[model samples]
Target chain A: MCELMAMSANVPTDICFSFSGLMQRGGNTGPHKDGWGITFYEGKGCRSFKDPLPSAHSPIAQLVTDYPIKSETVICHIRQANSGNVSLVNTHPFIRPMWGKNWTYAHNGQLADFQSRLATKYHLPIGETDSEHAFCWILDQLLQRFDGDEPNSEDLFHYVIGLCKQINELGVFNLLLTDGDFLLVYCTNNLHWLTRRAPFGKASLIDAEMVVNFDQETTENDIVTVVATQPLTDDETWHKMQKGEGLLFCKGQLIYQSS
Target chain B: MCELMAMSANVPTDICFSFSGLMQRGGNTGPHKDGWGITFYEGKGCRSFKDPLPSAHSPIAQLVTDYPIKSETVICHIRQANSGNVSLVNTHPFIRPMWGKNWTYAHNGQLADFQSRLATKYHLPIGETDSEHAFCWILDQLLQRFDGDEPNSEDLFHYVIGLCKQINELGVFNLLLTDGDFLLVYCTNNLHWLTRRAPFGKASLIDAEMVVNFDQETTENDIVTVVATQPLTDDETWHKMQKGEGLLFCKGQLIYQSS
Candidate 1:
């Protein structure tokens, strides 16, 4: 129903090269043309740019492609508007403050009867999207369990995985969520990921006629991991996640994986 | 110290003319050169653009001046960074969600012994700024009083005014806060406002050499009020607010005032 992209890097890095290919799919090569949004995290500060217009034609989207905003974690989404009307309020990459950190979420699939099933109390959706409702529901669960205190990372990871599996049972629920420190991805139907370290090579876009040599852009010690609903590059070996699987990454390294 | 600017309009209006002048103060005209931020409200959705760079030289700030994003309410700040580091996390115009509405805040003056005076429980500051600490303190009071329930506008306005008075006792606290429906302003020392209605005339900027003819740009039914730390335009008749005064505005009209 939509497309999602996220990046985690050991150093501050820009997603311009991958975003260039994804922007083409917003309206030029694909049908997800309702709206688009992106969030970049710089330390504890998160900045988001959302437009209620197709990314392929949005001047702000063009600015994003032109400006290289370096961030340790980034999340982006292009919407097809399955649950909510095409508006600025319904744009993806929804964000809220949790545990003194800005948590960002983006969804790529539709859920059935989400509003009726998911109950939220502490956090509420500003928009009418089912995706946002689900996100609020997840946060509600977290608040109920942790009660404003920070939980251990492993325990929190497992708790989030259990929540993801329950949401996945309703329908397709591929999700990307991050809180500037860690990125957590859950797959229901489609998701792919790849990590680039030391031995980086050239890559070509699958949606656009663009090529980038990672060797020229990254240092040898730099680690960068990218996750998306679909592979953006044709040459890179993207590892496809199985349904009902969840993964957590911190500083570009996989820290937890659920079998 | 920082420069604060805000607008409340009956209809969606762009702040390009006033922003042009205020941005000049970020570096060229004044000394607030640490960072700058602005938030524009579109229905329940708010979009913010912030840069930890000087607004006079930032390309993002240049784009903000060039692009006319229409909004019914706007809050902006150009920071001098007396209490916090010059980073994105410490930029002005902080936002958080409370009672299902996004509340935006910006402060112009500093606070003394703020960390010791402010005790927060429900919300915490992600950045180390006296302004942000004051904001969290105010919100904490609100949460304690209302407990997630919506309060009557008049009662809420008075309660907020009392809170502002308490914070002002600690130090200088010129504030602008909004929740999409209303704009509340508190003046500790310096604040000015002007309202333009029917029979609008030409206005010129004080910091920048730009002139705008509102008579040709606005409709007769449009009512727009702008508030700033200093009058942005040299020729406009701005009413200076008294110290320890608070005002509430909705739909460009003054609804409540306290001595």
Candidate 2:
């Protein structure tokens, strides 16, 4: 299994503070050390950084923690190589452009024979990874149903959740997907999220010895939502999603939920 | 105009030496300071770093230079922004995955009314940039001609050159494109290339006060081909490509040329 992290904010915000905690889990506090990747979406533009090296000691990961690249949406993953080779292509937070948007996806849990159903026309997996194959399969289905055009937001959200439900039956399928606008999350076994807004106080990392006071870093009008496989901070109140639950978040607000 | 740089090597080689010189031209030694980006292909996997900030002052660019990410092929660009706004979406070295390969592209010149011909079926430009739209147009043509599959080398190369000639007639269209396997270069007005092998010597950078001895850095079996909009090194002899010329290079070998 791997670990996933995603963020959606009303304004462009950095993940340095939360990423510092996640990096420690890559090898220091957890056993996941295969590879790591992150994607930041600024408007319609997407920027990604990936390393085959373990994030616990990767110099690039260190740079990410030190530098702050603000974005409206972000997705990150640390791999453990349960399904694919520990290579650059297999690094997660894979991105493809669809509907004139940078669509990025990252998977946390394993899938059983996921590629068996991967019959694609427009999108193809660049690497031999179950996660990438699943991403492509999802995109292909969306394209076929919508015919190269995006549907209404509600229809798109509902259709995606239906697809996730179909995949979740195959195995554990916790995922985070975004197209530089909204974040879609589906939970099979484990997932948690938290939102920060006005009257913010302090939060401390569970995996690292660090603390950040949101009062000093964010304004009263700032709204930021962070979703992860597990709670990243020890003090924050993270709400755990139920199994087979689907969610959609945009501009740091939860707008839709599966029935 | 912007600047373009690309490399094809027999081995996984780092472009720190050449990139160091190019970054200086981003804002320090030249005026093309709108934005910059680079894509490095290691095997079939690709890692890219892009910034709307000027490369000369970008901390991400500094990390890229300080950390050596070796790759078999690389495409880089420093934008002067003649056709698009100075934003992250307009940064060069755009990428799209096709035929299970990450196709990366960078352009040095602007096209006049190029988007008018863009009638894409599979690929679409997410950003408002002439270079990206042209890239999508090229891919759409490739997909249409081959019926959703890559054509044979001879046919693909000839067809691409023919399409490039058509685009070149519109305006300046010097471009570097790759599918992580081979580097394709199309010259409209100006481009230069240099290949270095066993009998290497000292080379000095033109934009920065830096010198490197290839003898100490490379093995006798290493072969590297570097392409740029202008000569990047002062002491090396670079070959200038002719107008309307299309060249294909793979594993440091020039394999095809247009008639």
Candidate 3:
């Protein structure tokens, strides 16, 4: 299994505060130590960084925690490597271009026998990971079903939810996917999310001795949503998603929820 | 116009020495100050770093110069931004996955009326740049031509060279493309290359005051080839490529030349 993190905000926001806590779990306080990867969507351009080293000891991970590259959408993953070997190619948060948008995907759970089972021809996985195979498979279905014509947001989200249900039958398939505009999350096991708006207060990390006051960091009108496999902060009220649930977030607001 | 740099080595080698010279041309010594991007291929995995700011002034660029990330194949570009706005999406070294490989491309010359003239359906450009449009068109043709079956290296190189000739007819189209195995270079006006093997000597940069003694940095078996729009080193004897010519290199050795 792996750990996934994603953020969607009304304005360009940094993930340093939350990432600081998550990095501690990658070999320091938790067992997800195989590798780590992140993607920050700056407009239509996505900046991705990946390392095959444990995030707790990686210098590049430290740089990520130090440098605040603000973005409207972000996705991150820390891998424990059940389906693939510990290598740069197998590092999480895989990306591909779809409908002229850079689509990024990260998975938190393991799938069963996804290599030979996957049937994707349009988009192929560069790395041999069950998560990547599943992502390409999903894209293959989406592209083939639409046939290059992107549907409206609501229709696309509903189609994606149906696809997630299909993938969920394979095994645990908690995933976060985004294409700069909409962030779609689907979970089979455990996933949590929280929205921060007006009347924000201080929050403390569960893994690290760090505290951040949202009042000083964000304005009253700013809307931010964070989704993770587990809650990063102890004080924040995270809504735990039920099994086989799907969500769609557009600009930090949840617009669609699976019934 | 943009500046392009690429390297193919028999062993994993750092491009810090060559990049130091290229970084100066981004703003200090030349006029390509719009943006910069680089892709370093470590095995089947590629690590890419990009910034919309000038490479000479970007802290990320400074980190690239300071951190010696070794790679066997590298592609880099510094942009002056003629076709698109100065943003992250318009940065050079556009990448996409093809034939289960991350195919990266960097262009050094300009194209006239490529946006509307390009006819591509499968792969689309996330950024609005003539170079990226051309790249997507090329990939579309390749994928359609092969039909999911990757051709042999020689056959693929011949097809790519033919495609390059077609693209060169439009305008100046000097480009470097790679799939971590083959480094294909096509030139219309300006492109130069040099190979350094055993019995290496000291070389000085043309754009910067940095000098490197290659004899102290390599083993006797190492063979490295450096390609750029302009010769990066003053002392090295680079072979200037002819107009409408294409070359293919594999593991730092030139394997094919245009007929």
State TM-scores per candidate.
0.98, 0.98, 0.97
lDDT by residue (tens digit), candidate 3, B1-259: 8899999999999999999999998888989999999999988989888888899998888878988988999999999988889999988788899989999999877787787777788888888888999999999999889988999889999999999888887899998999998899999988999999999999999988999999999998999999999999999899999998888888899999985
lDDT of each: 0.92, 0.90, 0.91
DockQ (Cα-based) for each candidate = 0.71, 0.87, 0.76
**Candidate 2 — which pairs collide?**
none
Q: Of the candidates numbered 1 and 3, which has the greater TM-score value?
A: 1
Where does candidate 1 stray beyond 4 Å? none
Candidate 2: misplaced stretches above 4 Å?
A: none
Task: Please report the TM-score between candidate 2 and the true structure.
Answer: 0.98
Candidate 3 segments whose C-alpha is farther than 4 A from its true place: none
Question: Mind giving the per-residue lDDT tens digits that candidate 2 earns over B108-170?
Answer: 877887777655667888888889998999998887788666776667778888988988877
Give model 1's docking category: medium
Structural RMSD, model 2: 1.1
Q: B-chain TM-score, every candidate?
A: 0.99, 0.97, 0.98
Better of 2 and 3 by lDDT: 3
Write model 1 residue lDDT over A54-89, tens digit each, in one string.
Answer: 999888888899999999999999999989899877
DockQ result, candidate 3: 0.76
